[model samples]
Target: MTGSVTVAGLGPGDAALVTPEVTQALSRATDVLGYVPYVARITPRDGLRLHPSDNREELARATHALEIAAAGGHAVIVSSGDPGVFAMASALFEALETWPGDRHPEIAILPGITAMLAAAARAGAPLGHDFCAINLSDNLKPFALVENRLRMAARGDFAMAFYNPRSKSRPHQFARVLDILREECGGDRLILFARAVTTPDEAIAVTTLAEATPEMADMRTVVLVGNSATRRVGRWVYTPRSAESAAG
Candidate 1:
């Protein structure tokens, strides 16, 4: 009995946001694996075995899921938001690269709404134009790399969405990020912080680079920095669709 590994996204915090495809995948899974909170979202069942682990154990978890699949068990790996967006999908492939076994298990990836899209929707169409998403965690990469990306994005005038902007361990990095943004985008550039989005504790705040501070964001927050053309209409923040209108 050949088995398979399914990587599914549970969406953001809301159960309503979870796609039916991902839900169906979970229902059919023989074993489920993911970070603790994401795995906790899965309901306990008679035949389904849940493997919850720490966030940093992604590669090991991916390997374990593949191992289960190799043994003819249907393994599902869950990620909050989209699995491909700075989540388990990449790690799964990385684990697969070093697999010693010749018979590789079947693999599938299911997409879901990421925090950037969810946050952007709640705060209005700040990403209506060209945009890019950057992970600021610096866990697997250098802070200098993150800084360079920020600078390049600003210089390119791209609307930017940032993930893992701030955490307790590196509280001050976001401050430097804001300083750099101020220098590149200037004082009037709009920046929005959407925290705990799609949950009961959700909060969204929009401000300018001059007034924005590091304390406005956290690990759960997705930050949006708009281009010069971004502005507010009524209460919604949006960037113009036309470059000529944006320039004018």
Candidate 2:
């Protein structure tokens, strides 16, 4: 009665955005685990056990999920947005590093729409051109490393999507990020602050680096910085598919 583990994405607060594969896995799961709010998204049923933990307990959660699977119980770990994008999939693989090879449970990662894609769509194709996604949380990495990546991405003129931009504890860091972007991408650059995309509380703000403020983003926000070419067409914001300075 060997069991298995499924890492499934719930897709950014919208029930309709969840993929069929993830839905199927959740339907068959004997136990579901995730961060507190993500686990709350699951409807409790008679046979399904829900395990919710704090956001900082990703490794512990992954280990627990694996342990349940190895014990012959079907386990599923849920993540908001795609699990592989700065989410549970990486943490699960990291936990597997110490897992005994002979007893490793079957694992599957099912994809879902990530925040950037959802945000981009709502903002009218701001990510239609070359782009990069960066998680701004300094929980697992150094602030200096985050700054360096930000500088490089701006220097490359890549449209950028940012996740976990601000939280209560590290409120000041996002201000520094805005400063860095202003330095590297210039003050006139276009920026979009998309908060709680597709949910009932959704709000989208389009502005420029000069006008962008740190308070515009909270943990639920996904920020987008367009390359020099990004602009408005009527009420829509978009970066064209071709580079601004490209040769014929």
Candidate 3:
């Protein structure tokens, strides 16, 4: 009897953001696996098989979690932010493809609040229209891919949010993003940086793509580059009129 699999979203930087479904899933999981920082955010369950590691160990950890579930243990693959949005959900499926076991466990991915959505809501309405999320880390992907995505967003005039924009090893990648936007977008494009949204020390600031310097951003910052239609109303930034407002 193989135990079920639950890919849970732990939410953005707060316990309060944990959904009831995710909380229920965690309560039933026998093995809870995730990157160490995310795993630590949840309370220690009575009998959870806790496995934590650095970000570099993602594949190995996902494989181990599946193995545990195939062996009839209730297992959970946890991620910060929504599990499916550039998070752990894809890794679980990819790892399962190479799995040799016959045991098919019930795998469920419960959704939760993502950092982009939460950050946008906290700072105002930066993502009030069509948007894009681009991950800047070149560790797993090529730098070309990152730039290509940026180019796409710039061309589409999509409101853009960036993830994993910078780290110790890749400090200047986000600066390149700004350059791409400034070249494709105008010099006055509204840009907002929301750091640690919904957390105790959260910071939100509005700037233009031409004005958002590297010093104003870090890995903790979720960056928002506005679309052609996006605009700032005092502290709040918004775009794409709602259907109700449009009809009126």
Local distance difference test values of all predictions, in order:
0.94, 0.94, 0.82
Candidate 1 regions off by >4 Å?
245-248
Pairs with steric clashes in candidate 1? none
lDDT for 8 in candidate 3 is: 90
| lDDT of each residue in 20-90, candidate 3, tens digit only | 99988888888888889888876885787688878877778778887787778988888988999888888
Model 2 Cα lDDT, one tens digit per residue, 76-120: 999999999999999999999977757789999999899999999
Best of the two (2, 3) by lDDT = 2
Model 3 weakest 10-residue run by lDDT: 239-248
Q: List the residue pairs that clash in candidate 3.
A: none
lDDT of 1 by residue, 1-248 (tens): 79999999988899999999998999999999999999999999999999999979999999999899989999999999999999999999999999988988999999999999999999889999999899999899999999999988888889999999999999999999999999988999999999989999999999999999899999999999999899999899999887864331
Provide the global lDDT of candidate 1 against the true structure: 0.94
| C-alpha RMSD of candidate 2 | 1.7
